[model samples]
Every structure is written in C-alpha cells, then in structure tokens.
Target chain A: MSDKLPEKRKIKSAKKMRDIMTTYYLDAMTAKQNNRQVAWITSGGPVEPLVAMDIIPVYPENHGAMIGASKMGEDLCIKAEDMGYSSDLCSYARTDISCSIVKGGPLGGLPEPDMLICCNNICGTVLKWYEIQARYYNVPLFILDTPICHTQYSPEIARYVRTQMDEYIAFLETNTKKKFDYDKMARVGKLAYTAQLLWQKVLNTTAHKPSPMSAFDAFFFLALIVTLRGTQIAVDFYRQLLQEMEQRIQTGISMVPDEKYRLLWDNLPVWYRLKWLSEKFSGHNACLVADTYTSAWCGAIKYTDENNFLDSMAEAYTRIYLNIGVDQMADQVLDMIKFYDADGLVMHSNRSCKPYSFGQMDIMRIVREKTNIPVIMIEADMVDPRSFSQSQIETRIDAFMEIIKQRND
Target chain B: MNNKERGSIYAGIDIGSITAKAALIKDNRLLATHVILTGYDPINAGIKVFEALLKKAKISKKDVPAIVSTGYGRASVSFADKALTEIICHGTGAYFINPEIRGIIDVGGQDSKAILLNAKGQVENFAMNDKCAAGTGRFLEVMAKALEVELNQLGDFGLNADKPLKISSICTVFAESEVISMIAGQQKRENIIAGIHDSAAARVAILANKIKIKKPVMMTGGVAKNKGMVAALEKRLGLTLIVKDFAQENGAIGAAVLASKL
Candidate 1:
C-alpha cells in the first residue's frame, strides 16, 4: 500500500455532481414558491414530458436511495410498517411514504407533488405506491403501463405504449396548465439520449485492465442521469465524467489500489454499506468493475433513436433492464461478464427490489453454466440495513474471494 | 507429528456459537485437540480452550509461534496472530484430513453450511443458512428439551423409530411447538426425533443442492456426531457422507493449519 494518494482515482467531477444534485433538489423543494408545478415520478417514468412542460420532475425512488445511503432507511421503513404497510413492500415505497408524512430523509423529504406519474415499466409496486401518494396529496395520477417484453418488443405493445405517451403529454397539460411543446421535447429527448450514451461510455471504460472506476462510483454518479436525465446539465456533467474516466484509463489509475480480481455486481447496492462493501472488496484486491443496477440507466441504448426521440422512447423505456424475461436478463448479465472480463458474479438478492432480484438464481445458474465462474448471492435490502448481517456477508465475501484466488492461481 | 520438530508448534482456536475447540499442530501434523462448552463469553472460551489444549498436549504457550482463531467468535481471540472465517478454516481442515474430499457439509451450533472444494483442496463455492438456526445444534437442543430427552441420546432414540413422524416447519420455534403437540397426541418420542432429523436434513440439503455440491463429501461440526443427523442428511442428499472422528475440531484444526503459513 502506498502512502501517497492515487491521483486519477480522486474523481474531480464528483464535486460538480453534488453541486448539481443539491441545486436540483433545492429547485424541486421550492417549486411552490417559484409557482412551478411539481410531479412526483417513478425512476422508470417518462420524465422528458415533464421537462418539456416545464413541470419539475421529482423521483421518490432517487430520494429513497438518498435515504438509504444516509442510513435513515431502517427508521423510515419501520415507520411505514407501523403505518400498516407490509414489511414485504418495496423499501423505496416504504421509506418514501413514511418520509412524506414525517419529513424524515436526507433532504427532509421530497417536495409535495401536484401530480403523480406512475410507470409500470419497472414494477407493479409503483402503481400502488403512487396511488397511495396521490390520495394523500390530493393529486391527479397518470399511469403509463408498459407490458413486459418477455422476448421481443411487439408492434401492438409499441403502439399501446406510444398512445399512452400521448396521453402522458395530455396528462401533463391538464395538470401543469401548459400546452405541449414539441420543440422543447425534441431537444430534451436528444439531451437525454446523449446523456445515456455518455453514461454508457463512462461505464465501458471499466473494460480496460485495472478499472479506472468501480460500480460504487457508478452508483454515486448515477443520480444526475436518474433525476435530471433530459437536461443539458446532465449531458455536460456526464461528458466531463466520461473524459475523466478516459484520462484515468490512459494514466493507468485503478479504483482498487491493488486490483487483481474483477467482479460484476447484480441488482441494487446495499446502500448504507457502500463504503464498507467497497473497502471489503478492495481489501481482497477485488474490484467490482460493473453492476447491473447502475448500468440500467443506459442498458437499453440500442432501442433509442435521437431523431425519433419521443416515438423511440416508447420502445427504449419499455425494454429497460428490469422489464424483460429472466432468460433475457441472464443474457444481458452474460454479455456484461464477457465485456468486463469479470472473474465472478456477486448478486445482492435485494429484499427491496423484487423485479431486479427475483430471477437472480436463474441468472446465477446461467452465468455459472456458460462462464464456469463462481457466483455468490448475498441476501440484503437495498435500503433497510436491518436485513443486513455483517458477519454472514463478510464470510461469504471472504470465501468467494478465496475461490476466485484459487481458480486464478 | 515429528518428535524432533515438537518445538515448532502452531495453535488454532475456534470459539463457535455453542462450543469452543482448540487444536495444536506440529510439523504439519495434528498433535492434540480439545473441545469445551462455549457457554456465554466467547472471548473467555477462546482463551480457555487454547490453554486447555496446551495443557492436554503438555506444551507451553511459548512453544507455539503462530495462533489463528476462527468460527463466529474468531474476532474475539485478541491473542491470535490472525482471525479467519469458519468457511476457509473448515475447507482447509477437511482437506488436511482427507485431500480426496471434494465437498463439506458443516452443521454447527447456530448455522449449517455446504462447501464445494476443487481438486487443489481449495474452496470452490460455499453456502450457509442466512442468520437462521433451523438445521443447527441449537435447533436440536430445543427439540431435546421439548422431548424431555438428553441431547446425546437423540441419535439412538431416532434410530429406534419404526415410523418417523413428518415435521413440516422450517423454523426451530415452530418445529419445537409441533413436537410438543405431537407428544401431547401420544406420538412415539423416537418417531418425533426422527422427524426432527428429517426436517434438519432437508434444510441442509437445500444449501448443498444450491451449490451443486460434489460427491465424496464429508460432514463436519459438533452435530456430525449424531448418527441420526448423518443418516438423515445422507438420505436427503442421496449420497454417502464421510464423518471423521475429529469432526467437532475440524475448524480449529484448519485454523492451526492456516497459522502455519504465518
């Protein structure tokens, strides 16, 4: 271990990202004062229409990540359970619901919404979650139902989603009391597409030996793309981030101080334990080069056409990483393993995110059969730290690393 | 152990959830092994086991150059040169005992686990019950108390059953209540014990099947001494399991083996 700091590993773009996020949150929080309508949106909801209508798009899921990372998830989750919500419900929904009532989160709580946008592209849980919020806030709710694309995206499904996209715009018009601006939407769509592309390029930089960044870093940098995806700020920030990652690649600076083994992470991160998990892997000289969660922002790149932004988004948003079959999900995981040359797979098996964690066993089996690489499943919640057991997870990680080392040796 | 190399000794102490074990190794050979009740204090159990083993081996603490501690209380051994998890220690110990062994099924005090070993005697993969005591010694102890029988006499009683009752619950608390209800219903004690073993074996088998555990497997840990458990697990897995004489001290022996590297 060297005493000197690793120069390129210190991501300079992180400060700017934080500043941008703080500004975005402040803007959302003070939307009422600014006479700007706020629309609470799901992570997988179409935010471009909100951007086009000048309605501030606030994501509870993103706020849930903040709550989890801040280590306030356990309390918020308990509050929701006390309020009669089942513990089995998604932690994001639980935390967000409780935080709305108690004003308990990193940001005190998300801005109260005048309208709610529910997208089932991610999961069915959001539909109920948003309905609960809409009733509580006395707001109109719009649901964009994107049927699961088990294998392929059919024209009928595409037509159904596209028609809803129009209804989505109409819903925005009704709530915001503003006309639909196609010109601004086209621009926002292009920016969103470019941001996604840059995010992909940033993630792809890990393909280089001794990865310049890790999935931990990706989890942090993912905020802009998730919240303010259609804005020029996100595009600018990602472009800068991409350049820094490329520089780190050229300079041969790795995130893991002594990178020997590279692993791919599946599902959402154990949010509160990010630093501990990062250090644990780093201690073993294993770098989590990629994860399915962070890469999800750009996972459906092939479906988008910047020219046909609105129309193409119908396909792109519908065919996200979580909106597919297990076999297809496994195929994506296999492709990631090959792309990053990962030595093993670490699946979180998150208790909170059912859509992401449900078919993980099948994916693990597929990865093992195809690659013959060791796969470990860690049972935990994305937000709730109560579900995490340090010693149990530590043993699994240590034993997993030993196997990788043995095979490598 | 080579008599000439008795001066160079290594110690491994495993303070598990229910028992503490210590093994002394000299010249790549196990010199002596000791096991005692872990009781309440894991830190004291680690120290007491090491001292007891030293006395049993007729060796001073100064004779051992390195000491490695393992098990749930591995970190409690403040005097050890290093602390390693039970998973690695078990793999190393099982391999040291029989290099031919390709898989390991360890059912400890509070948890059960399955480990797959490669040809090089390294852990290929492993799985354990996540913070559950369904298929562990604790579960058996509770069942023993419920049946008003001695824990050691459980194996013999289970073996004598003509028709084992079915225990459906995967939870120790629920299973114990089920056993109590069975007793009230005038069910035979041996049949209930056999049912308990069957349920435990089912849980352990799930972990083993998940990793696709290889054959030529060996059973380790304190519960391995229970003939009924060994029989039930073998039946569930549909494969023969090799239970060593020093199964209880396997983790401690593996820790000692690991200490040799230090």
Candidate 2:
C-alpha cells in the first residue's frame, strides 16, 4: 500500500453555501432591527408572493431540519412532549413549537414572524402547527387549504385553490400594508421556475456512471431552493451548482469511491445521522444517487406557467409529490429508479410524517413487483433521535447490501 | 498440525444479545458446536465460545483456517476474517440444512426476520420487525418470567390451553401490564401463555406477509425451539414450518460455511 493518504473529494461549493445560509439566518434574526417583515411559511408553501411583497419568508421546517442536524432535536422534542404535546405529533411541529417558547436551536430560534403562511399540500400537521405558532406570536395566519388530488386535479379543486390564492394575496396585503406587486411577482415566478429547472439539472447530474454527488449532498444543498426560491440569489446559486456538478462529472470525481451499487432513497433524511449514514453507505461502495424528498422541490415544476405566474400557482402548489395519489407516487419512484439506474431502493419509514409514511408498504410492494432490485424499509424519525436504533439500522443496511452484491455477482 | 497443514477446518462465532454460539466445519461437514450465555462481555464470550467449540471438536485453534463472525455482536469478534449480518447467515444455514427451503422465519433473542431465498440459496428479499421487542424471543422470555415458569416450559404449557386469550397490545411493556391484569382476574397460565404466543406470532406474520414468503419455510434461531410459538406462527401464516436439529446454531453454521469459501 502507498504511504500517501487518499485525496478527499469534498465539494468546493459547500463553503459558499454555508456562508450564504449563515447570512440568510443573520438577516432573519435581525429582521426586526432592519425593519423587514418576516413571514413564517411551510416548506411546500408558495413563497413567490412573499418575495414579490418584499417580505422575508422563513421556514420552520427548515429550522427543524437544522435543529435535527445540530443534534438538538431530542431535547426540543422532549420539551414539547413535556408541554403535553403528544409524542406522536410531527417532530417538526414539536421542535418548532417548543423552540418558540424556549428560543433554542442553532440561531436561538427564528425571528418573530410578522405573519404566518400555512399550505397543507404536504401534510395536515402543518395546519395545527402553524395555528399554535400564530396564537403564540399573535400574528395573522393565512392558510391555503389545497385539497388532496387523489387521482387527478379536478377543475373544481383548481377553482377552490385559485380562489384561495386571491384570498392569500389579500391577506398578505392586509398584513404587510403594501400593494401586491404583480410585475415583481412575474419576475420572481420566472426566477423560481428557472431555479427549479436548474435544481433538477443538478440532481440529474447523478444519473452519470459514477454519481458526482449523492442524495446526502443534495439534502444539504437543498436549503437554498426551499428558502430562497423566487429570488435571483437562488437562481444564480443553482446555476453555479449545476455547473459544479457537470465539472465534477467531467473530472471523473464521484462522491462514493468505487461506486459499485446505486440506490434511491425515500422520505425525509435522518438528519442527526446524515454523516453517519452517508459514511456507512460509502463504506459499502453504494451511493444514494437520488431521493424522493429533495426532488419534491422541483417535481412540481411541470405544472407552473412562467408567463402567467398567479394563474398557475394553484395547480403548481397543489399537485406536489405528497399531495397526489399513492399510485402516482409509485410511478414517480419507478421512474426515478430507472432514470438513476438504481441497484436497490432504501425507504425510510419516518415516524413523524404520517402522509409520507402511510403508503410506503404499498409502494414497497409495487416497487418489488415492477423491478428485480431489492428494497429495504428502515423505521426512523427525520428529526427525533429517540426513534433511531443505530445498531439495528446498521445491520439491516449491511444485509441489504449483501443481498445486492449476491444478485450482481 | 500448525495452521497451514490442517486448512480445511473453518469456524464461525455468533455473538448474540443473550447467547454466544460457535460452530466448526471440516470439508463441508459439521465438526462440533458450542453455546454459552453472552453476559455483559461479547468479545470475551466470542473467545470463550470458540475455545469451547474447538475443545468439543477435539481440535486446536490453529487447525481452523478461516473464521467468520455473525449475529448482533458480529463486530466484536476482532479475530474474524469477516463479519456478516444474521439475516444472510440464517438464510444460508437453513438452505444448507434443506436446500428446498424457499423462505425462513428467524426469531432471535432481540429481533425477528422473514427472508425469501432464491433457487441458489441467495437472499432474494427480506423483512424485519421494527425497533421493538414485541414479536422477538425476548418477549417470550419476559412473559415466562411473569408467569413464574421456565423459558423452556412455555411451549408445552401453551400447547395445553383450550382457549387462548386475546392479547391486544403490541408493545412489550403494555402487553406485560395486560398479562398482569389477566393474572389479577384469575386467568389460566396456560391460556395466557398461549395468548402471548399468538400475539407474537401475529407480529411475525406481518414480516412473512410483507415479503410474500413461499412454502417450505424453515424456522430457525433460538425461538424456533419453542413448539408453541412455531405452531402459533404456522396457524397465523396458514402454513407449516420446518424445524430441524441445531435450529439455534444455524447462524453459526452458516457463518462457518461462508468462512470455508473465504
């Protein structure tokens, strides 16, 4: 063996991303001193309107992910449970709820929201979570109730959500006491659309022979698309990210060395164990090429109309990955499997997100019947470390990889 | 002989949560096996079990050419040539015993799994119980303690029940409390034991159904020795299970077989 150490394959853009996130949080933290209105919004909620209205949009779900990554999820989750919130509630809701009172987390809790925007396109837990926060902060809460489109997006459902879009704009105008800028919204919508397209390209770069980046990196780089969407900053950053991915592919730099097997992930990441899980997979020469979670940000881009921004926001927000039927979701998973050329599938049966975890068994069955690859489901919580069992998960992953190796050999 | 002269002998050590087992194989034939309580030190247990197995086989440690370690404490065996998970080892062990076994339901001390095997005895698919002890061997041990009965006696006692009571809780702690209430209500011990077996069988059945396990399934692991649990699982799954000798040491045997290849 050579005496020299192996070269580290760290992504150079990570530093810039971290710096941008730090500045973003700093801006949110001092929003009051800077005389900027901050609207706390859901991860799946529409943020172009907020950007058009010159309101800084904040995401508590992102904060929950940050808390989970910081390994402070257990204390906040326990605090919420102590406060009589059921342990069964979503971890994001629990962490954000407790964080509001305790002012905990990486940035000492998010800036006090001038308004709260909740869109239940992802899960029903957000309604009550935002309600609790609205009552605590004594702010006006705007709820965009997008009914579930099980089979298809019906015309009546579109009309219902479209009317709510008008009401949403009216609520924003009333809270911020400023006129909604349609011209700026047009520009923001186009930028948002471009950012999503660029994000999809960044994800697609992994479809190469050896993935330039894995889903773990996507989970980290995803903060910008979710937090800074509908802004020139997000568009420019993703453009650079996509270029970096292409460059990495050209130089033959893959995330997992000797990537022998490629796997696709499902549901939210176990944030607290991101590094551990990544290392574990890379140790086995398996790269998680793509995931259903990060791609959900760009998955709904097909429904958007760049020119008529407000006209198509209803359908674009309503027909997300979580809002659609299980069969449709299975089809998307199958497509991802083929597109990424996955050797197997690893599904995280998250305990916190009910909607995401509810139909995973059926999806597992569907994937098994439709493909020859092996599939494994790991029970875990995205944010709550209490639900995680490290040794057991380690064994399962090892066994799963062994099966894959057996099949290929 | 020194190590190189007798290279045909291979060894496997399985360091489980409650017990450590070791097996020796020579030229694809079973040589000897030994089992002992793991206690608090798995690494030491692995060494002790291997030494005892070598003694039982009337051979020296130097005769074994390769060693593969398995089970929950697989990584603890620093001397192993390699470490593998119990899932693949169990499937291999069952297939080695009876190549006709298309599926295996292994209920070990802490976890239970249902594995589907292909024609060549390779694991095709598998499903394991979540991070709970509801359907595992530990669940039965806990119930046996509550009933003041020996762990080995639960199978026979459960067989005598005329009407098995229904157990509603899937959580081990809650199920224990439920058992306490039944005892308070003067329920029969055999009936309660039967109920616990059925509840645990029900949980294991989900794993079987998840993988869509085929017929000719083998029951392995320490819990396979319990005839009552096997019968309950058979009834729940609408199929019989094949339980052969050395069911508990199947993982170690499989590991030994793999070590020979290594």
Candidate 3:
C-alpha cells in the first residue's frame, strides 16, 4: 500500500453522520417510553405527514440496507426462505420479514410500529410487503396508489393521488389520536424540500474533476435524506455535509487518489461489498463519481413546489424515478452522464429489485447508442450475499475498465 | 530492465479454472505454447506451464523480460509484470492473428463470452454468461459424461446425427435429466449429442447477438475444438466462425501479445 494512509481520504463528517443515525435509532427504539408514535413507511412514501404528526418515521427499506451492510442479510434471507418465501423475492422484503421474527438485524429489530404507510410508486412488492407487516403487527395500514406515468403526468392521476393525501392525513389522525397540523406540515414540507436540494448539491460535488466523494460515500450519507427528511436535523446535517464537500474540493481531497476514469453507477449498491467495490475501482484510478440510486432521493425535485408543498407533492411523489417510463428514465440517465462527464456506466442488474433492474437493458442500449461510452452490467443482489460471485464480477469490472482506459488513451 | 536488452522475448500465462496455458513470443512471432490441467493449485500450475513453455521455446526465464497473466487465476501468477483481463487479451490475440477478425465468441471451461473489437484490435464491447454454467465447455463435458462418450469423440458422434433433438432446459443439472429421459426413450446417441450441441449453441448465441457481434468473428477457448458445437453455433448465429490452430491457447497468446507492449 502507498504511504498515504486510508483514513486520510475518509470523510470526517462520517463519524458525525453515524452518531446522528445512532441517536435517531435510539429515540425510535425508546418511542414507547417517550410517548412517541412510530410510523413505518416505505422509502418512496411521503414521510412529511408523519413527521408533522410528531410520529417517528421508521423505514424498513433503510433497515434492510442496514442488515445488508452489517452482513446479516444472507442468514435473514435464508430464514425467510425457510418460512416459505420464494428465493426470488426482494431481499429487502425477505430480510425485513425475517428480522421481525428473529430480531436479528444490526439493531436487534426495529421498534414496533403503531401504523404503516405503503406507497406503490416505488414498486408493487411494497404493497404485499406492508400488508404482511400490517397483519403481523395488527396495526392500521394506509395504501397510497400512484399511477405509473409512462408518458406524462395527467390531471386525473394527480387528483387521485391528491385525494389520498387527505386520507393519509386522516389515517395519521386516527392512528395517533391527534388532529392533523397543517402549519407544522407546511414547515416540514419546506424543510424536506430544502434538504433534497442540499442533498442534490452534495451529489453534484462529484462533477468536479477529482470528486470529493464517491457514490459509496453518497450511499452512507443517503440515510439522512431517506430517514430524517422533513426535519431540521436532516436539513442541518446536509448543509454541513455540503460545506465539507466544498471544502474538500477547495483543498483537492479526492476520494479516489490519482482519479482518472470517472464512472456512473446504476441501481442499488451491493451493500455488503461496498468497501470491496470501492477499493477495486480505486485500484484502477477509477472513481464512481455518481450513481442513480442515491440521487433518486433528490431526482424529482423539479416537480416539487416548496411554496405549495402539499399539492405539488402529489405529482412529485407520483412521478419519481422508478414510477416513470423507461425512456424517460433513460433520458434522466443521459442528462446525468453529461452533467457528471462520466467515462463509463456500471449498471447493477440487482436480482431483488425488479422495478429498478427490469428496464436496465433498454437503458443500457440507449446509453450505448446515444453516448460513446462503455457500459457493463453486473448481476448481483443488493443485500443477499449468496447471489454475489466475487471472481466473476472482478473479471467483468477489470475488463470494463480496460476498455475504458483504451478508449480514453 | 529493458526488454530489448533482455533478449526481446515476452511471455504470458493464463491460469483458467480447468487448465493452465502459457505462450511465448519474440519479435512479434509466437515461439511456443503449453497447456496442462489446472487441477486444484493454480499457482503451481501457472509456474509449471510457464517453465514448460520456456523449455519448449529454448529460452531461459530471465530472457523473457516482460510477462503478463490473464483468465480467472490471472493474479495467481505472481511473477507476471501485469495482469490483464481475458477480454482484452483475447481481442488483441485475435487481432494479431488476423486483423480481419472483428468479433470473438470464446466459450471457455466455465464461462462464455462474446467480444466486439474495433479495427485496432481493442475491445469495443463484450458480454458474458450470467452466474451459470449453462453454455460453457463444462456444460458439454457434463453431457459427454452422461452419454458415456469420450469428450474428443463428441463432435464425430454428433455430426453423424440424422435428426438433431432439442434439449429444452438451459440449466446444466436440469439438462442432464433431460438427456437421461431421452436415453430412457431409446434416442440414438448421436442424436442426443447433436441436441446437446444445439442447446449450448442457442445459449451462447444470445451473448453474441446481445452485443450485435460483427462479421468475420473468431472462435477461441477449449470449446472451439468441438466441430459439432461449432456447426451448431454457425447454424444458430448464421455466420461461420474462424477457428485457427491456436484456438484453445488464444487467451495465452493474447496475454503474450500484451506482455510485449509492457
């Protein structure tokens, strides 16, 4: 190894981020003693309402990611399979389902939810997943159905989702036994919007020649936007993180030293192998400057109106990345490629995520035809380590980097 | 440390899952090549194959100034100057052999790949089989064992087939059961062998078509030696494959070509 220490390249904000996440989980774990209601919501669900209601918003998908990063996914996934779930089911759902029974995640298990909020905008799997959890906990469940915007978001679709916004507030009122606070929601909505913009700015820092942070860092920092959005905590945390990124850029502290080839990643990260993958790319002087996954938390910001957060959110949440057409998704990807000036694209054909992975082939072809960059698809699961093939993936990445190097040379 | 001062000879070692291969070159011409079963110890196999190749080429190890390694066990060759992926090596090797070759379908012991090359012999694009052994050399090896026929004789037996049967399963284990059922039904051995080739061809053809493989394609790797599999692939892909004398040793040859540049 070089004399330059590994810790020298690490983001100093990481320790602070970890502390915040630990505190957040601790508060949620003791929600009962604090007389706080916990609402387990989907990652793509509108969490601002729950935030405004003073209910601790817990995310099972976030918990799934934690299990994956801690390398507890394989055993939990096997347990779910033993419980008669198909091996092909989403690993997040499987891990969450099994973690409920075994209490076997990084945190023993997530605190029991007083209510559940399910949104189908991200995937159809969440509907069934949340339904199963609702039955398991015997709690109230609210489902928000968003029509897929294959071409354009229509008024009819907007109306349907907007009505659910009212029902969502009513559901929170019924479950928490408190009236909906519109003023608090307005403030939360603005904070959520501000956090997303800051998060986007943080992600865009990678557009610098020597990216201050890699997508791997983004994956770590993404937890706040996903879990603590709509809170001053998330907004304040991102502002500080963004300032650190700008400082790193001013000081020329690149995540990958001697950064040469910049690549863009698609789909969820192989959470368990993030470090391995980071070092592998870094070995080639390649930095994964940006990714579609982390940016997803901020991708639909153009549709949001902070001044009128409630009404515009219906459209914003409905037309998010995974809910749109493949062609539209490809368009967004192409835009990102140009913005980031990426040399290559690495697509993860995740086995567990059907929506994210399904149209990837079409997107890959589109990128190939539109841009003169090399694209490689790695078949793997985000959480389930058993589906990962180390040697095969290594060969593919090496070969892909070779081609990129040749083209750039 | 100048390669020219050290005799201007380059060496390459490719340690695959099932076999170890070595090749040597001097002044842009291939000197010698060697192959042996990789077995369990790839590090030992890599050394043995390289030493055997040097002996065959009448050169000492120190004379070969630059060495490159490729394939699955590429990193096992600790002596190599650089380790490159087989995709680039194969492309460079095929282009060195024939500049007209624009695409390559390499079906190795455990993996199948279709690579597209630019006019300069650089890999433009490529695709590999997923985490499965459905269309690789090992797939045919398993079928040969199930049919109780010698691996080398599979081509002749398949070529004699009057009507090729169709094997439906894309999985190796499931396909073996399909073959057993055909054997129980009294299907001819030659026909069963032909069916097996067709199944493997169909699977490999998908990789070729996925990258839209270009014309004048070259076939490499151990599976290229099977005439029946070649014919099936030709029929399925609607293009003839260029298989030369060094087909099985192509990866090693490519690695050697890259070593000279190092």
Candidate number achieving the greatest TM-score relative to the actual structure: 3
Q: What's the TM-score of each model vs. the native? A: 0.96, 0.97, 0.99
Tell me the tens digit of each residue's lDDT in model 3 across B1-262: 5566444889888898888999988888888999999999999999999988888888898788899999999999999999999999999889989999999999999899999999999999999999999999999999999999999899899999998899999999999999999999999999999999999999999999999999999999988999999999999999989999888899999999899887
Using lDDT as the measure, name the better of candidate 1 and candidate 2. 2
Alpha carbon lDDT of each predicted model: 0.92, 0.93, 0.94
Per-residue alpha-carbon lDDT of candidate 1 for residues A245-326, written as tens digits (9 for 90 to 100): 8887777778888799999999988899999999999999999999999888899879999988999999999999999999
Instruction: For each candidate, report what fraction of the true interface contacts it reproduces.
Output: 0.70, 0.87, 0.96
CAPRI class of candidate 3: high
Better of 1 and 2 by DockQ: 2
Which regions of candidate 2 deviate over 4 angstroms? A1-7, B1-7, B184-186
Model 1 spans > 4 angstroms off: A1-8, B1-7
What level of docking quality does candidate 1 show? Answer: medium
Q: Over 4 Å off in model 3, which ranges?
A: A1-3, B4-7
TM-score of chain B of each: 0.97, 0.97, 0.98
Number of the top candidate by DockQ? 3
Query: Proportion of native contacts in model 2?
Result: 0.87
Q: For candidate 2, give the docking quality class from DockQ.
A: high
